[model samples]
Target: MPVLISGSVAYDRIMDFPGKFVDHILPDKIHKLNVSFGLEKLSVNFGGTAGNIAYSLSLLGEQPYVVSQVGTDFSSYRKWMKRQGIHTDTIRVVKTDVCPTAHIITDLDDNQIAGFHFGAMKYSAIQATVVKHKVQKLVKTKGAIGLLAAGNLDDLLQLAKLYTLKKVRYIVDPGQQLVWLTAQHLRTALAGADTLIVNDYEMDLVLKKIATTLPKLTARIPRIIVTRGSKGAYWYYGKKRLTMPVAKPKRVLDPTGAGDAYRAGVIMGMLDNWDPALTGRVAALCATYAIEQYGTQRHAFSRQQFKQRFYQTFKQQVSL
Candidate 1:
């Protein structure tokens, strides 16, 4: 089975701020706030929703295709993806611009502020046009799953339309891009999707924007997953809803890419046709690995190790 991950492919420049962000800000001056925090360290890593998900899936023994647009400065990231055994032939390269880059600052409380440069990612429709044939080919494969993660609004909508036309199963994760998506855009992107994944806040935003209740939304979409950091996640399918607790991590280093890692786990479970309960557990465990590392694509573990940790965390055996 192949996984088609369509999203941005960018570099994550992460900086660590030693103090809490709230301590330095005045509540009343929020409208005219001016503050700067000295960073402790800065590290540049290969990231982006598509890249991160593909990397984690590859680690789990799935060679997922990354459908994205990158720029001239993407050679290093391309090489890195190849090293990880991910498929990148569908990634289009723009010779004129630089690859998209995300500048992120994280406080001691694991809170983050990020700014992303669209760069080559803005040409997502062009990339989608170029890779239509390749994507269709992959969609024909048995048990192929398409993941529409955070990226250019046009790219998400285009991919969703294509997936629906091809009758392929897919998951829609609006993520940070939800801010820019109108009710109509959200509806269009999520149409015919097999599942919808979002954090608690994002889920709320979606409901508010769409002017619909969870039950009403679930009536259309087969499944909806809302993740709560530290607390756990909720899965809504049909008339039933299931809750899953977070897997305890060895140490929480950074929470930047945990959601992407969790998504890979979810896709893996979907491919295996595992029980939803077990799948949610697997997803939570995968997220634990991500929070334990500072960078998104830095986590690594063998199948055996993953299974062992699953048992340790949830007291249930899992075969990955």
Candidate 2:
């Protein structure tokens, strides 16, 4: 079975700042606040929730089908994907003139400020209108798994419904877009997903908004994975709470896309049918690597290297 990655594809423009962000802000300014810092350098990389996940999966030797839209400027990004052995045939082009883009700035302390322009990403809603046909065509040979990463709100809801209608196993990962969804809309998206992956902050918000217990929140969904920054991750399913320790990072450069990297590890684990404990450890290791690099796609390691890291961190051999 092929894993379908449905979400945004864009260029990530990263800027490096030499000074701490706190140096420019005044606490005694009362209500006035204005500041700007000169950037030391700028680097562009192929990234987006979908692209990041697909890239991570490729490192693990999984070829995920990315079904998303790109703008006219996607030439280089497309080239990179093909070269990386990711399945890009399903990628569509937006009718617009430019592709989606994310601008991020990281300070000396590794704090980040990011802004996203949904350029080509906006076309995802239109793509959702015909996604059933797309799904049908792709799954003709075997069942396909889906991970609905962050994108247009309506597309998220529609794709969730379509996946449920077809009974395709899927993971719902709203990411930062969770803020754009209403409680009712969130419930709709969660109704039939095989699993829901959210960070600790999002988990707290979802619980508050949905007004439900941990057990009740996951009643319809089989599993809910909550990631806590340095503490590690937790999985709630079938009246039990499971925990996985963190894979210590070599160095923390940027935490921008660690969550997506973790999700890629989770998908890989699912494909291999690994135990929950093993899956969580794999995800934690992926995240550890993600934070060690400035850009999401910059984290790369061979299977042998990853296996060695896994054993060193968890004191157990890779079973998958």
Query: Which candidate number would show the highest TM-score if scored against the true structure?
Result: 1
Per-model CA lDDT versus the true structure: 0.89, 0.84
Let me know the TM-score candidate 2 reaches against the reference structure: 0.92
Off by over 4 Å in 1: 125-129
Off by over 4 Å in 2: 26-31, 125-132, 139-143
Clashing pairs in 1: none
Per-model TM values vs. the true structure = 0.97, 0.92
Q: How many residue pairs clash in each candidate?
A: 0, 0
